[model samples]
Target chain A: MKHTHAEENYLKAIYMLSEKQESLVSTTAMADFLHTSAASITDMIQKLHNKGLVIYRKYQGVTLTDRGKESAIKILRKYLLWEVFLVDKLKFGWSEIHEIAEQLEHIDCDTLIDRLDHFLGNPYCSPHGIVIPNADGKIIDKPRWLLTDLSEGASGIVSAIKDDSVAFLQYLGKRNIYLGAKITVIEKIQFDGSTDITIDNQYKINISRKITDNILITL
Target chain B: MKHTHAEENYLKAIYMLSEKQESLVSTTAMADFLHTSAASITDMIQKLHNKGLVIYRKYQGVTLTDRGKESAIKILRKYLLWEVFLVDKLKFGWSEIHEIAEQLEHIDCDTLIDRLDHFLGNPYCSPHGIVIPNADGKIIDKPRWLLTDLSEGASGIVSAIKDDSVAFLQYLGKRNIYLGAKITVIEKIQFDGSTDITIDNQYKINISRKITDNILITL
Candidate 1:
């Protein structure tokens, strides 16, 4: 079924929130994410339910139907693809591409997005390190090991990170451990879960447990 | 001053048309370009005149002011840059990016476009070979020579082409002489205004003088 940009956004939000929480997406949460009133969310949800895009029940929240999920995934693919183009090709900062991608995700052309995917050389991940799903919603597999999972003396290349927060990315920038950096685990602190790693035969840096958990490495 | 997407489009159309034809842009021409009614065009043009974005005189057509022209140029830059991203990074066909870029040009955010400019490495021309004006309206200098200006046996690269018609672009595609392809002039037949050119040392093709004139070359 044809959907408006506003409807697609609502569906995508519900799909994302549901995935994170593993439960039905609440109207309140949808309203919060969309910056609209709960009543508005309820109205929109009802419309989506009528269209069979969602399975909705009052006070029980909502979960998208297969068609709705497919639509949401398609939007996500376009969004992440555009994000990769913005960062990898255009050199846009990761923090900046989100809002623009938000606006771009609503562009309703499949061929354009497909061609864009080719233009970007079919990037596996966006600038913020999020995996971009393919046209059929198949996720690209990349070699990734968690920083905290590495034992002392284990070595690998930094492939990508999971967290996309601006502050965390900036901290990574300061540490000089960007994507494609080679590093070895020097030590692992038992108490706080921090790790000491050497980068490029030069600087030895201590990474907090929280930060280490977010970093991904190629085995 | 802020302008709506509709207003910006009108200004851009007027600016582009004025560059080729008379300074006065007619309602019928604008209506044809925008696919809107002549009455709607009249209403919007008057509104733009009131906002001082255009100079409008009854029965004399419309002309954009300097401010309007600047805004129009900015929109053009965004549109064309997005086209580059769509084609170069996303792998979209030249014909496909135009409609998507049309939608993208309406996204109102300077930070987004500026960052996008940086992300796309400040491209001077789009995939369809249109020059993208810089932030300050400075056109990027490229080594361009018209196909009509080439002497017999002169060698050059295809930098851009003037025409965007689907048939012409398709013809170029069929001949494998897209932007950035190297070409060497083989022979020029003055009688018929036709020229034979060698492409990438593989094939020599004969092209009419009209086609040659429309194609731009880089020395």
Candidate 2:
């Protein structure tokens, strides 16, 4: 089904909110996330509901229909592919690519995007470690847990990052922490939730609770 | 001044028409070029005039103001850069890239496009041989004339392509003619306007006037 860019954005926002919250998304919450008013969100939600893209209840909030989920996933696939292109090929910093990819994502040429996917070597994740949906919209999501959740001496490879702010990624860069880096928590300071860790089993570093919470990994 | 995508398309159509005809762009001419009605052409022309983007007269037709030409060129610059990316990196055939690029040209990020230009090695021409404009809207346009216009024994390098239809580009590809290939007209059969040519002063080939007229070259 053809959707205006605005409609697609709203659907994508709802899909993301539902996934993150694991529940129906309220119009007020969507308005805050998208920086619009509750009135505008309600109006667009009604339009999407009429189009069968959403299941909305008067007081219970809304969730995506199957078709709506598919559409949002497609947009996400395009967005992630474009982000990869910007960072991997175009040499853009990981911290500076989202807004540019937002515009490129709306271009909606399946052949162009698929060809771009092949061109970029069909990566499984974006630079941010967010999983990229494949051609069939399947994402083989690996189980990941926060760094702080691991017991002392437990080791895992950094498989994903949950924060997007530039400062956080740059701090990780400075500390030599990134996706695929093998890490072991040497000791845990439970008083403030900081941990001493060895990366690649080569160098030991210490990070605070904020960093541990944002870094996710797989055993 | 910000122009809508529709307005940019109209200005670009006018700029192209005036360049091709070397005269004012009539409302009828614009309507035909844009696949719209003359009434709709006049409506847009009025809006453009109010914004000082175009000089439109009731019966004398319309022409782009300097501002309008600049706007059109910016769109063209983005359009052609995307064409280069598709062919150079994505392995898309020149014949298959124009429509996809038409959608990408509307992505308005100057820094992104400039970085792309640098990333692509700052190409001088698109796959079709159209010059790419620089940051300040400067284009170092080479003087080019039709292949037919050159006399026998004249040598020139193919600098530009005059037609964008898929069939035409594919035909050129099949014959091994491309931007930067050098050729010399060895003989001209003026009766049918067919010519015998040697490409790169090597492989001899014969082409009709139709092909010669569409291949622009510089001595």
Candidate 3:
């Protein structure tokens, strides 16, 4: 079923929020994620529920039906593909592509997106190392560990990022950290959850617990 | 100023309609072009006028202000650039790219567009051979003539297409006619205004006057 831009956005927001929390996605959380009002979220949730895209319970929140999940996956597929195109082809910084890809993701054309995926050589991950859902809405949930999970001697390759905020990405840039960088935990601070890591076995830098929590790595 | 998708679409429609006629664009013509009601067109035109994007004179119609024209040209630039990307890179047919480009043109990012322009190697025209305006919104309107104006035995290279309708473009595709094809007028029938032409000194086909009038050629 064809969906409006607003509807698609709500689906994506609900999908993302669901990933972080196992419980039903709260309307307030959705409102915060979308930077909208609680009342607006409730109204849209009703619209989505009527469309059979979501199941909403009074005072509880909502959950996507199977159809809604599929629709949201399609949006993610488009978003990741365009992000790949922007970073891989157009030479945009990984941090710079999310907002642009947000707009591109709403472009309603499945064939165009399939063609773009092929043009970009069918990337499996976005520039931020996030896994891209396949054309059939299948995504492989690869094993990943947050940087904070490692001990002082543990080491791994940066595989994905949990946070894709521009400020976070810019900070990563300033720290010379990037996807695929081989990192070794040099020191684990006992006072705080901060960690000192050597990047690619080269430059050593200290990162806070917040940074470590967001940076996913594969041993 | 940032423009909504509907507002930008109206600006583009006005710009395109203005190109066909020298006078102000009528609400009826805009409604026809946009497939909306005359009342809706008037409502939108009034909104545009309030933004100083257009000068609306009741009954006579509307013309874009300088700022409005610039905004329209920027939309055109994005549209044409995406068309080039779709056809040249994504391998989409010339006819198929317009609708996709229509969605892509509304992507709002000056830096992304500039990067895309650079990535596409600074194309001069779109897949359908329409001149693309530069970043400054300056377009070089090259001289072109309708194929119907070409006399018998006159020949030139096809430079642009006035009608980008899917049916017309598909017909051109079926007949192996394309942008940059060298077409020679073999015969022009005065009775019905249909013309016989040879394409690339190889394939010969007869096309209707409607086709001839829509194909633009340069001597």
Model 3, range A108-189, lDDT digits (tens) per residue?
Answer: 9879988988887676578777788988999987677888988888898776677867787778878888766789999999
lDDT, each prediction: 0.82, 0.85, 0.88
TM-score of each: 0.74, 0.73, 0.71
Better of 1 and 2 by lDDT: 2
The CAPRI class of candidate 3 is medium
Global lDDT of model 2: 0.85
Best by lDDT: 3
Q: What tens-digit string does per-residue lDDT give for candidate 1 at B86-177?
A: 65455455666778888899887787787777766666577667778988877777777888788888888776777767787778878988
Interface RMSD of 1: 2.3
Residue pairs with colliding backbones in model 3 are: none
Task: Give the runs in model 2 whose Cα sits over 4 Å from its true position.
Answer: A143-219, B143-219
Report the TM-score of chain B alone for all candidates: 0.70, 0.69, 0.68
Give the per-residue lDDT of model 2 (tens digit) for A1-219.
Answer: 778999889988997898889878998899998999999999889889999999998778999999999999999999999998986677677777989998888886778889988987776678787888998888888777899899998999786677877777778878988656789999999888889999999989999999999888876
Report the candidate with higher DockQ, 2 versus 3: 3
Interface RMSD of each: 2.3, 1.0, 0.6
Which is the leading candidate under DockQ?
A: 3
Docking outcome class, model 1: acceptable
lDDT of 3 by residue, B79-189 (tens): 999987886677676667778899999999989999999887776677677799999999987777899999999999777777767777678878988766789999998
